[model samples]
Target: MSDGLEFLTVEPASDPVARREIVDLLASCGLDYEKQIEFFVTARQEGRLVACAGFEKGIIKDVAICQTLRGSAISLRLVSEVTYLAHSQGYQILFVYTEPHNADFFLGCGFYPLVEVPGQTALLENTPVGIKNYCASLAHYKVEADKIGCVVANANPFTLGHLYLITEAAKSCDWLHLFIVKEDASLFSYHDRFMLAKEMTKDIPNLTLHGGSKYMVSRATFPAYFFKDKGMVGQCRTAVDLLLFRKYIAPALGVTHRFVGTEPFCDTTRKYNNDMKFWLQEPSSIAHSIEVVELERTKRSGIAVSASEVRRLLAGGNFEKIKEFVPKPTFDLIMNKYATSV
Candidate 1:
């Protein structure tokens, strides 16, 4: 254990350096020591290893890396963190194998027996790794609520600008449902990033967190290959989001308005906003409805607050610049995760 056990937050699957520490953490947690693979790590206050987890790509196995000292419980946190990390990087299920003695540990982590796997040993178990699974059956969908607002942003690391947009939207709405992108397409992993956003705004009244799903923002909906397809993907994504919200979620949940943060610089968001506004407000789009509330920028460091700039600053290691773009908890999580990963 190091001097002042600090829990450093690692970035996403893209980081090269932090990946090494993750390898070591895997070994510490008694897992395979595969190199050139990607994962994330976190530690305790004294800098001792508290908890660490990661996702494997190109394979559907839900099994991951985790280290919880004897008598310590990393259940909810570890499972949720891995689920967020996995889904962000394109994973659907998490599988695990624990010795009979550790069966208690696994069970407490929400693992029920998956006796259907056909193995005589019966070692295979399946566990959900994302909020969509957790909330799909439990989350109360609103259908006729008064003053409903929706906001979506990839808080790569929460910044002050995000706070501004959220606060500004809160001004007119009765409840603010923030949809933080859960996929880790950026420098930070989904769990670390989402947890930051959650911490920062947990104090706000009537504010809820929404984890994005493929049904809403997956390859089937927002394909990444569109990166080279010029602008095909963006328009397609906007259309998918519009269609899904209008056709599926809106009717079940009485949503009257969606809060969109204005992009002063990014062309992608500008276009997304335009298409979104038109589809929601324009009539004849029978069955497609809901008011689009465009949120103005809350200035920070003279530049408009945006998740893009926040990513830019984090990549440059500018902790100071990040302070203005995200919420405090989000900023801290980004700093810790970035520091450890970098």
Candidate 2:
């Protein structure tokens, strides 16, 4: 509705300069613009980038506007355009992460704030299924009080390290709720990863598996969390995710303990684990405690066994090397279903 405002969808490949301008604008606003830059909407005033919003799948991120245009309708128009684009692409549920000061603008744009990390970040969603509703559905699967443990994993291809973590966590808790990352944003399909996890862990009697809904480290969280980007962007994303879990998911399931494997490699994951330890500690953040278990080392190479390593082996046609890291079920699936041609 703002006069002299022009809205354009800037593709990173086609309009690299415009994309760089948008990224610079977002970076000036303390937002990360490194990831999910493939498709974005920008508002220009007389050819100057004034406002912008980026989307990846159902997520709306890297939203920014020039300080002078704060009170104008530019933000609303940006949100509307991005939301419409997401809906047109078949995304029924959309999420946006914004700074606390800018919460009201998005709230007016029909997004409800789910959780906020004080001065850091706020998670909001524009959908019929709010956080409360989604958490409530999970409540139905709640176990006995103070006896449950949880593990949120992507299982890009469920590795033996994952199996070891789950098995060890199950040994200490009465019930283990394994939430497989349901976001299909990785090399392996969510279905394949989920099924592989189920098949491998089926023998563990006390382990219960659930899909890591959007509330968990899915599209709702910044994609940077999965990547190598470290610093405030990664920290904020990790904090918001763990905050959501500690506030909504943990309490609902009576989860007294959350378990994660120690990251010897990925700095992003290691920082995430460190943040989890700080955020979930008693009398400060949440009631649940965190356990950082040691990662399983490969039998042959003595390095940490990880999905990334498995993928590397697969890519290099070193299928035999992957058997040391991934579970038998995962190896079978990759060899038979996915890597048959290779």
Candidate 3:
């Protein structure tokens, strides 16, 4: 299937020459080369780079074949090699995002389309049943309520602000579903974050504290790399994430509203909140109607309480001030972990 082409795998982190060739190829093909890519699979015909694909964790991107070879069988062979390499590294489920027009090419390589942003991008996975199975599992957690509210949070270290937001939001809705971001790319591990959230929200009678999933705000659903224009990246990220939420996650759990704390610190987060409003509740005839509610951030000493502040304080060895920003559970965990040093 290679059509007399030789395939070679290069780890871009160490092979700068190969990486440059890939960057040039992607540029010529009109796709930005993402530095976060771990490796690349290159197809060379007589030692000239004719096709290439990149792998970052479980995501496959930057796939570009020379225009002369676009319709040839080499494209499939290139993707198959990349998929095989990704699976060998223990990534069971692989995802790819491409121009909506190029989605069919990947479909030929066995990727199932999950969602598309019309003219922008299309997301696809290796297995057709991956999202369907996830939604089916979520259906078991559905509860009956006139107004079903939900809050998706990372809660790196559970803060008083988070507790306040969830507590107050729970009050306004008959049932609130709190989903903890499951990706462990934060200062705190997902297990500890989940424990802290569980301990703090235990008293809320009408709320269910659920663990994280890939379908929620995760690296796969919301990539934070590759694009030159950060604004366009934010738009695409929120569109993909929120579309999945409204189309699949919300419907599975009977959720009608999403609650978020007002963002005043992080630009990325503030943009995400704004995009959430546009994506989830835009008055389009084909759009799903999921209300977005932004609650005021809890303040202390005239300053808003935030997890980032807690992290800063912890880093500065100012445990005393961290106590004021976080709940007792988080403070206790911090003290327990840093007892020997502090």
TM-score for each model: 0.56, 0.84, 0.94
Sliding window of 10 residues with minimal summed lDDT for model 1: 115-124
lDDT of each: 0.58, 0.80, 0.87
Can you list the residue pairs that collide in candidate 2?
none
Worst lDDT run of 10 residues, candidate 2, spans 291-300
Q: Candidate 2 lDDT, tens digit per residue, 302-323?
A: 7788777788888898887888
Query: In candidate 3, what are the lDDT values of residues 1-342, reduced to their tens digit?
Result: 336799999998899888889999999998898887888999998889999999988888889999999899898889889989998999888988888999999999999998888789888999989999998998998999799999999998899999999999999999999999998888789999999999999899999989888877777788652232432353686788888888789989999999999987766678789999998998755446999999999999988888877877888899889889998889999998864565
Score candidate 1 by lDDT: 0.58
Of candidates 2 and 1, the better by TM-score: 2
- After superposing all C-alphas onto the true structure, candidate 1 shows an RMSD in angstroms of 15.0
TM-score for candidate 2, please give it: 0.84
TM-score: which is higher, 1 or 3? Answer: 3
lDDT of 1 by residue, 1-342 (tens): 333434444654566565555556666666664442355545554444555554445211223334335454444566666666667776655544344455556667666543211121122234543323434542475524578777777666566777777877777888777877755565667787677778777788877777765444433333332232332222454564565556555544456788877887666667778887866676744465789988777886578887778777777888876776666677666656575665
